[model samples]
Target: MLNRCIATDAGSFATQYWGRQPLLSPSGSLPRDFSDLLSGPMVDELIAERGVRAPFIRMASHGDLLARDCYLGPAGFGAEMPDQVDSAKVLAQFAAGATIVLQGLHRLWPPLIDFVREMVADIGHPAQANAYITPPTSRGFDPHYDVHDVFVLQVQGEKRWLVHEPVHQDPLTTQPWTDHRAAITERVREDAAIDRVLAPGDSLYLPRGWIHSAEALDNTSIHLTIGVAPLTVLDVVHAVVDTLATVGEFRTSLPMGIDPTDRGSMAAIATKVMAEVTDTVQHRATDISEGSATRLSQRHAQRTRPVAVRPLESLAAAEHAGFHPVEWRRGLVAHVDHHADRVVLRLPDRTITFPALCSPALDALHHGLVADATSLPGLDQDDAAVLIRRLLREAVVIPAKQPEHPTRTSRG
Candidate 1:
């Protein structure tokens, strides 16, 4: 997605100012045009014909957001509370100089979906995409900073953008720009770090808390802003805190009838608690297999959506409507737990257990290599097929390319 969004190499950007300073890419170096992902007609079709709903699309003008009820109303009688987008009303507002904001396009639009997935795969961070369509000579929002880092890609026309230095550096999600609205407005007027006219194909990277606002110039303008909410140390701390719940001292209630006004009692309790905390942290540092930080990372990986899956039509074409020629999916790992009688494979979506005898075959497949149903070494064709089929059903594996007759690659 940074194909056109950055002029310099991504490695250099990460090294110098990934989350520290502003960077601008002049564009036109892209192998292919980026505007093909969205256009005027596409926006029209989404609002007028696609029946998009609230929270997905919002309209703003002169810093005030139009309420959802203003453009959406009830439809289909007989106890059905379904709401439909009022296209005519929205179009009228747009013509009247309102800016249209398409929210969560990473989940709703196909092109952005692919882009976001690739970004997550590459950067290991959750990302979302939104597009802003502003009318000529109009500003959509008042000057403000975002709580997340954003990659601004100008797709159509031109937008005059004023980017100011951050009032609060690296603001958290809980820290809204509104918290320092006065400070931000004051700073935006004093001096700007970057004030440029972003034309089609141009792109800019702004770290969180950098105040910004834009106005369409000469003609209608559209831009895609890809927001990245990078995982922070606070997140890892939270995960660890969650695991601390298992500790006895952490779970214990405060001293019975402890006076809220008594500092003596509080200090006594705190000292005891500190010892427990210190000891627990020391142990956690020594062995982190069951620690919160490791668990949090594992949980994150388990919750990630599969980047690819067999097509519906392909499934229907396979024998018995089952996916064939499968392999382990990327961004996934099968966690194993051994029991006396069976071994369990924990997947992102589900868990499965098989007789302990199959552990060797399971380990073979878990070597981070692609394989077909016939690849299991010890099992006969029928047993291997059954095992592979069950694994596919649980989404533990995916269809693989030919030559894996089973294919293979060294575990990285």
Candidate 2:
């Protein structure tokens, strides 16, 4: 929830906790139900069913061959599992992977998915939210920092984090640089100033560029890392470059033949091109913001059709209590309100506006939690069908429960 923290003016947590100067808002607070979102048995099932995979380092054991390292060992159930079994297993898995990069929420265990959805909705950037879990006694990644800002939540067990001040002030640049592995390693060895253990319910905020590493404590640990994607000057530059590609001057090559003595003419042409590029870049931020909002508003499941049975008319009337519909995709959340005759969905890209009339139908089709058209009071069969078709076309309604009959529908 990048904007949530920004909106609440709590974006300065990095400065408050890590002694860095404040740059963004510092008003928002972590959700109180953060722990309840991840600690449970459903998580345990994911751990037990998963397998381990890691990179191999060369060893001199038998004729310069690579040996299999047992970082977290084979993924298996613990005999004396912690009370919060699922969270522990997820954390253990994360540690085992060393540097797990999660994308879509569909890859996450069901319980975690639910928790993430709620949190993203509350934070006001539901469409731009995602979570990553790590395993115990393992380090999935080498000591490194991220390009995006992150909020780390310790749901179960404990994890030890070693933090180092950022050496590169502007880390998230479009122009690539050589990996800073050697420098980071040297810095960590020199002075380990920020080292702390993150226990259950504990939270850490790491801005983009600050280097850090994590390892599980004695017990297995499960933690959720909520990453926020920020807009930057580089992003604007990229958009401007992309837009400039359509211009005739950008498409045409420079006049190289008539150059040497006509340097003044060529310079004037170059200046004109530069002016256009600069103007585009200057206005690119607004375009990026709108694009972001559009992405947020339109994000939803990719279901082709609704699966759950629509509620009966009597039951629909009895259970018509207004419930906010929340969706989580790619670590972002979208909150849907059925009142005010409008539906507002937010994401990292932008906020989308839709008619409130479509909220119930959209939620029913996307989440698969509420009943379908049959139960909805105002929606008729045709109306539900149209809405479902529209959402599917927009890539918002994803498949929910599989159809019982294999031949019932055509696959996308």
- lDDT to native, each model: 0.77, 0.48
**Tens digit of per-residue lDDT, candidate 2, span 318-345:** 2322221211112223455456878765
Write down the worst ten-residue block by lDDT for model 2.
Answer: 56-65
Residue 172 error for model 2, in Å?
3.4
lDDT of 1 by residue, 1-412 (tens): 5545677787887888678998988765464356777888888888877767777888999999988776676555653444566788787888999998999888677888778777766667777889999999999999999988898988889999999998899999999999998898789878788989998888899988889999999899999998888787788878777778766668877767789788998888789887877788887764433667457667677545555666562353234312256656655645777788998987655688898867777777777556554567667767777777766666666666555355575432
Which residue ranges in model 1 land beyond 4 Å of their true spot? Answer: 2-4, 28-32, 74-82, 261-272, 286-289, 298-304, 308-323, 329-334, 338-341, 356-368, 376-378, 400-412
What is the C-alpha local distance difference test score of candidate 1?
0.77
Each model's TM-score, in the order given? Answer: 0.86, 0.52
Score candidate 2 by TM-score against the native: 0.52
